[model samples]
Target: MTNINTEVVLRKLLDNIAKEHNYNDPNVSVRAITTDGASYSSMLYAATISTPNKEELQLFAKVANVGEIARSQLLLPLFDIERFAYKELLPAYEKIQDRNKLSNKDRLVWPKFYGCNPNLYEETVVLENLKTKGYVAYDRLKSIDWAYASKAVESLAKFHALSIAYGEENPTQYAELLAKMKFNPDSLNKMAGTFDKLVDMAVAVTKEDNKERLRQYILKESGFKNIDKFYQSTGLIILSHGDYKPSNLMHKTNKDGSIDVIPVDYQTISANSPIKDLYYLIFTGSDEEFRRHHYEQLIDHYYQQLCRALRNLNLDPEKHYPKKNYEKDLKDFMPFGLVLGVLALPVITVEAENAPSLQDENGLNSILTTKTSNLYPERLNGIVNDYVRWGIL
Candidate 1:
């Protein structure tokens, strides 16, 4: 986007914020606004909300509006999904918990929702600035340690449990909310050119014998043939955070050395097999040693918390979601991660200099050309080898 257009977008966003929070008061304005990683698809702004009394509030604004190119490529109205997650779905879940008398500790995963404008065309959601409280993303190039990985999955458990609780309590409303979650199975088509580019990069870096299998994996319709169905898991479905990468997570290290994980980025969320979230996080976030040695432990950890959450919501875990079902679903849904891994590895491993400026017309093209770190191939290799060993390839 040109500088003039960018400023205009930001200005309209500010106006939205003022209207919602400040009664459109001229006495309130912004001191400064800046962009970050989300500037590609969403306009992320951090600023000081100034009032006539010199009092100020630190806030973050996430805005999404598609141009012609973006509408065709991304395919869905992302702002609508996020707005529904914050405005409707979550609130309903919270209400279910309130009637069950669950405390804050029992219902803790998401951020504080401030306000949102799901205007169909121009969408903006304002939130409390967690940055002001010292929250930050772990280095994207670095693999999360056991501590970080554990907290990250813990949050995922809490999030998925909310959906189950809501569904169990009010089946009708849960069905309605799921209906609003829009998806296009063929939307994956737009990524064809880029997926091919990523495959070439993966093939180039991979060891020889694995290269053919990798190509077949990309070419095979079997791999993603049932993706939309798996994403909309028929029997054991829950709300899966669609893009659950380390970059989408925020953490703040505490005095005791353990970190507090706060999940963000609800734009791509879909109702799916809960294991889909686990696959993206474990494969893309953990190194081989952790997966080989402690992977089962991590799975057990998420289920334990999930069951505890179920009990808190007055549902029996064994009757509602047995441990055996979770184990089976984890391996069954592993194939979906293979497809997601190829797509995510590049973005996960790209450095700032090589990363695409997703704000421009040539932006999608820029992403295809981003340089991949050594980890990209290594991670891609890990997914391919795992799929073959599991007999899915």
Candidate 2:
């Protein structure tokens, strides 16, 4: 067993792997290591390792603990799903590569996964560095463009297709595994107050008629009381990138002037309606005019690509993810767009440094804070107008 407290042991572990991978230069320097969040029972590091040609490769290393917070507080009690994403999820993800029947590859499109090892203290996963690839991070909600949106929609379709294909081919396994999966409503509930605040902002920015309409809809349709019911009844469960926001997607421009969307941070992977991802992406990322102009086209585009992907995976889109089912799911789950907009708009529309931190309880409550004056008037007005125009209010 290696000691967790000793930096030497950790460095040695990284160094040995560097050498084995033909990384030369004989000297390995650990540049920066830091925890990604308080909720995870893991450690993430931004490391620079010497490569064969004496070049430094920036990599991310993830180590899994005995159990993660989600597993303990959410997954175990709800779905009996285990924690330790690096140990559990990574293996399943890697198996997709091993099968070779799918088009998933690590180096070109996806983040490359290096070999994993288990020590007495913890398990470790080494990943190919992404920083050297010129990946840029931008807030999805605020940074919407044709190139970004198109790429994102296409990539998401592929991801959803993979899940549908896997589920169809392995029905028994899919059902069994998903049965243990549970949604942590606690997190949603925790953010309820923030949502309320967002609604109040929306109300203020809207015209009197629209505001009343929104108020009625908020009370009757999208309230916290009925949100869970919507999720439960929606028969559109697929492996959703739970956190399908712009920040989680990385982008790099190719020589041809096209942008590629690379999905990272799979920790929030869950069985949810694909529309949930769509709702989150569009509501948070796109502006009112863009959404108003392209909403129908975008929705149709997403479904079309999703169906194409499902077909590519040899899965019948009609049987599992038909248009009828998608429409029904949208009717029930699309309210999340409004609901999350109320809660997310303040933060999503604000300057990064000025936005409330998720780490603070006060900031958390501010998410539900009913004060509209603190938000950007233009954005809030736009959101209210769009909801009204869509008849969602």
Candidate 3:
């Protein structure tokens, strides 16, 4: 969007906030507006504004991409997913917590949603500017240490547990929001086709043995079936943050070196198995050794926290979400991580210079093309080795 267009959006955002808060101050105005970056898909703006009391309010706003809304007919409605999350799901989670009597410090941590505008497929969500609060994303190029990884697992468990508690309370309403959202099968097929091209490109660079292995594992007709199956898997379904990679999570280090994890970008949430999000976070953020040592431990920690969360909500975890059942689902869903890695690692490892332009209308194909980063092949090899060790092949 041009500078003028951005200013117009900010004006609309201010109006939305004022209307929501019932503030009718004529003097309230945006004094300054600065964009975060253009490389990211969302158009992010940081605004400094004067409120009715002459108080300064610093806010962060994420405006959905106009390109995706215009070109991709299937993705046009995807914006509503995030808006629904902030508007509906988050509030519901908090209500459950309030009933459970969780302390303010123990509550789920996320950006405070001021309000939203989902008009004409141009979704705009106004939220807290966590940057001013000392939150930032971990460096994607580096592996996460145990301190951060443990916190992440525990944090994710808390979020997923809310799903179970919510489902128990409103069994029929667990997936109510997602039931109304659209998921085009054509987009899934197109996504598979794009991954096929990516694997073919990767085959040229892979070792002979590993090349055919990846091809047979990822390029066969079953590849599409597996992808479809993941999308359809609803067993033990609950609300999930669809994209749980490091870039989507924020953290901070205090003077004592303790860390805080706060999640952002609720766009990919679904009423699917919670393991999907955990798998995405592990595969995309960590390496083989990290998983080799901590994978089982992390999984255990997640379930423990899940039980605690269920109890906090006054539900029996053993009955609502059993440990044996959760373990079985984790194992059954492990292969899906490989499928996700094939699609995610490429985008994750792509250097800025080689990264695809968002201007490209071809969607995932634009980002799935061959990469110049040697890290890509190393990461791919590690993931393949993991699948083999886990006997997931």
Candidate 4:
């Protein structure tokens, strides 16, 4: 796909993987792992490396979409960030955990990385095939229920906690990583106009009672300013999974009736408030009904898990982030849910048949203006109603 020359690049990567497993003259086969509307930036492939010893390793690979228009529209740095995440950041976190002697249950869950090649057009990230491990991605259009949400938030808490611990243990390395993860705000600025257009589209379709309030709140400079602040805030900074949603996550139900979740995408990882990830997951992955029942409880659960994880890392949550401060930040950043919901709902709720074509040269602009399902207005109204009822609108 997209002329990636997989024979040259992927074959080499697979050979390296075979060597890593001490396998001699392994046979490798690859096939496309296609999912409708799954990713615009990368092509997915599943590879199998079979050793002469009768062992097999299933691998998942993400190859960059190098079409000129797609490359220009999506942030190129995001690919680098994901490479850094699997290759460097995760290994560093593991070393920190090993030093603290944390048990497997308390460790951050992620796919085992095999390798990555950061060549511009041939960018590829390969890892253990989670599907072979019985993990499946949740349907993007479905609102995540409580059982699934709990597992996801817990995993998210562990991820954030490890980031805090890693930063505390290696301050200089953490700082350098943060600097590299810093995104160009010009990208944000370019999208601001698109966001305004989307809000206007949302206002057009949203309920009559919600239209004025939603428009009045989001169409103003203050609204976009608040979103801008979310990206630039200095207080209570932690490594954030910038795109924490069900589509970017994989899950499985185990024998004990427990849900297993691990985040698979790291393209948008950045340094921001932990709540950024929390709220983004809540607002983007859940519906208003789920929120009405579990919003407060989820917030409390995340904080508790975060505290548990921090303690496991030998850091006192009270010293690093107190409950009182968390509450304040939660309130201060509440607008983010509405901001992200309106901007994301259109793309998220679009019918797969109506989803933006990756072949389009317009790239991100096509996604912003694509036709959406009837669910879009209902979801947008739900978000607006909540904000209005909370008196924030």
Candidate 5:
């Protein structure tokens, strides 16, 4: 393993690209590199052209190598699609970019694409560095506020709207793209095993009564089995952020203290239900009361913004994404969110030291690593209690 010459290969690749881009003496430095669980492939990183005079100009590079992982893995495979999407799909969206078509006026929805090179062995994506602008990763379980949640909801609406519009207007293109996307039931099954382990841990941490209650709930209905039903029925698929949670969202504060959210980690982008994103965010971020008081409002906000965004693209939301269709989709997908919340809350809402390490082979970090600790048990319990209150569990 140590003999693996990834760095050598990466440096050579960067050197060639740097010369092509006309970067002066681009001395690439490895900043950080890591794998997102399931050990076959690795994400490699390096900083290029760092100099005092050109300090204002920074370049960050990411290379995704898919060695032996299953073809069905979610987020990891999306790196391969990024290049294709950036080249073919993104231009279409850009062509229709207008105030009415997007929820955010800033036009900062997708990551600014620099370049992408996808080879048979590995894929590399060069993107704009958001770090220089004071944007930081935000985790709801660790440190989240209303501003962050609102901004996140707004951004999600715009993203969902774009996909819906694309699907409606370019039916043939959408079908072809979805055909390329496949959900790996096996990988999801493996994830279910981890969920079972997390439930066991939560039971071990709670009182006998609560433990039994939680245990019964999970044993009766909470796993891939439940989610499979939705996949079978409507197959309500779209371009989904497979791993949607707080940690993957980057945010910055405005002068008046409002926050703007930028989503990162497009590796898991897939053709799935929009509800997947909605459910994951709600379960992982807010608690019971928040949902009880604001669930309908949040859904309304999301749908309204989505409709507005679609309208901006000159697409009729009433015809393309009807209210009835959205309602049915939400109803079918809410259970996924509820069960996922039950499975994810304990793990997400724990103290950093007490919680499982991302480095742990069987920890939360093994899947999606978030630096924030806002998802602790207290917050999680509130979310759980809300589900119970809403009669979702």
Candidate 6:
């Protein structure tokens, strides 16, 4: 965007923030702040809005991805989903927490929305900048440690709890939101060919005898083709952060030696089995070694946190999501971990230089062809080995 157009948008955003917070005579300064290889779909910026009295407000804005490849990948609808999340879904969640008198620590925390313009290719969503408050994105190249993973799941559980409350408290509105947020399966199916190529590449490196079984499962039985049916199967359904990996979360260490995590990037948000979110976080964010040591523990921690969060909101866990049902869902969705791990590891582990620019027709194809770090194969082998050990392959 030109400087003139950028200034106009920034002024409009600051004016909206002023209207909400009663700022007078605000002056705005903008700067690009996106991390290298941090986001694939949008440009990120940090801005400061100052008043004559010297009061300042820090803000973040996500500009829509502009390219034929990006649009073909359904970036526009994804932006719509994110805007709906900030403008509609999160506000309702906050109201539910406020009505229940939930503590701040127990509530679902997210960036404070300023405003948005959903005008076609000019799409933009603005919100309070958490980075100014010491929050930082986790390094994508590294596996998540237990401390970070635990806090992340805690935050995720609280979010799912609030989603459950929203559905129970306002069934009609919740249904409408679900209808709107249900992502296009065709958009996902577009990547099926890419994953098919990924599967062959994965199998070529497989050392285990059961590698053929892995191929059969992913290609014939458990690929993206079956995702809709799998998610629609009998399970506790809620609004899920569809891309719940480390890169999409921002964290800060507290004085008490605990990490506070907040999830961002709701562009891929959808309504589905809550287990799908858990699988995404674990498979996409952690390696086999981390899973071997803490996988079951993380699952238990998430459930425990979910129960607590639900109780804080005056909901009964046994009535809504019992342990037996959760256990059953885990067994039913077990293959999802392997499938998602194989597909996401490549994208997540690609070096910055090899990352897709999203500026050309072949941008999305870079997901299949990018040169990834050795971590990719090591992690892929780990996931396959785990499945083999568990006899799931």
Q: How many residue pairs clash in each candidate at the backbone level?
A: 0, 8, 0, 0, 17, 0
Candidate 6 residue spans exceeding 4 A from truth: 1-25, 183-189, 208-210
Please provide TM-scores, in order, for all candidate models, with all chains considered together: 0.86, 0.76, 0.88, 0.94, 0.79, 0.92
Cα lDDT tens digits, model 5, 10-95, are 56666665666666775677566442321124454645554345543354566654433333333246566667666766677665
Tell me the spans in candidate 1 whose CA falls farther than 4 Å from its real position: 1-8, 11-39, 52-55, 119-121, 217-226, 359-366, 385-393
Q: Quick one: best TM-score, which candidate?
A: 4
CA-only RMSD, every prediction: 3.2, 5.5, 3.3, 2.1, 4.6, 2.6
lDDT of candidates 1 onward, in order: 0.71, 0.63, 0.71, 0.83, 0.62, 0.82
lDDT of 6: 0.82
Which residue pairs overlap in candidate 2's backbone?
79-180, 141-284, 141-285, 193-368, 194-367, 194-368, 197-368, 197-369
Residues 1-393, candidate 3: write the lDDT tens digits.
Answer: 332355576677777676666555633444333222213456677755555565566678876554542336343355687788888888999898888889764667889888777774356788878888899877776777788987787778789878777777786665565575424456665455666776666566666667777778775533765676666564677777888878788898889988889878888776678788888888888888888899888878888877876677777888877888888888768777777667777778767567654544665456654354777777777778887787755
Judging by TM-score, tell me the better candidate of 1 and 6.
Answer: 6
Give lDDT tens digits, candidate 1, residues 97-160.
7888887666655666777666544567877778888898777667778898888887888788
Q: For model 1, what is the error of residue 25's alpha carbon versus the real structure, in angstroms, after optimal superposition? A: 6.8
Instruction: By TM-score, rank the candidates, best first.
Output: 4, 6, 3, 1, 5, 2
* Decoy 5 TM-score against native: 0.79
Question: Residue 10 CA error for candidate 3 (Å)?
Answer: 2.5
Q: Which candidate is the best by lDDT?
A: 4
Residue-level lDDT of model 4, residues 223-285, one tens digit each, is 665567777666688889988989999999999999989998998888788898998889888
Query: What lDDT would candidate 5 get against the real structure?
Result: 0.62
lDDT of 2 by residue, 1-393 (tens): 222643444476677777777776556665545332221334556666765566665676655533332233332221112233444554554464346465542211557765454553455556766767888666533547777887788888878777776676678987865654546565566556645666676677766667788788887988877777545555877767766777667888889998878876666667777888887888777778788777788888889988876666667888878898888887777678777666666655555344433223343453443233333566556767876676666
Predicted candidate 4, C-alpha RMSD = 2.1
Clashes of 2: 8
Alpha carbon lDDT at 3, candidate 2 = 28
- Per-residue lDDT of model 6, residues 279-387, tens digit only: 8999888888899999999999999999999999999999999999999999999988877766777778777777776656775776776777787888888889889
Task: Report the error of model 6 at residue 152, Å.
Answer: 0.7
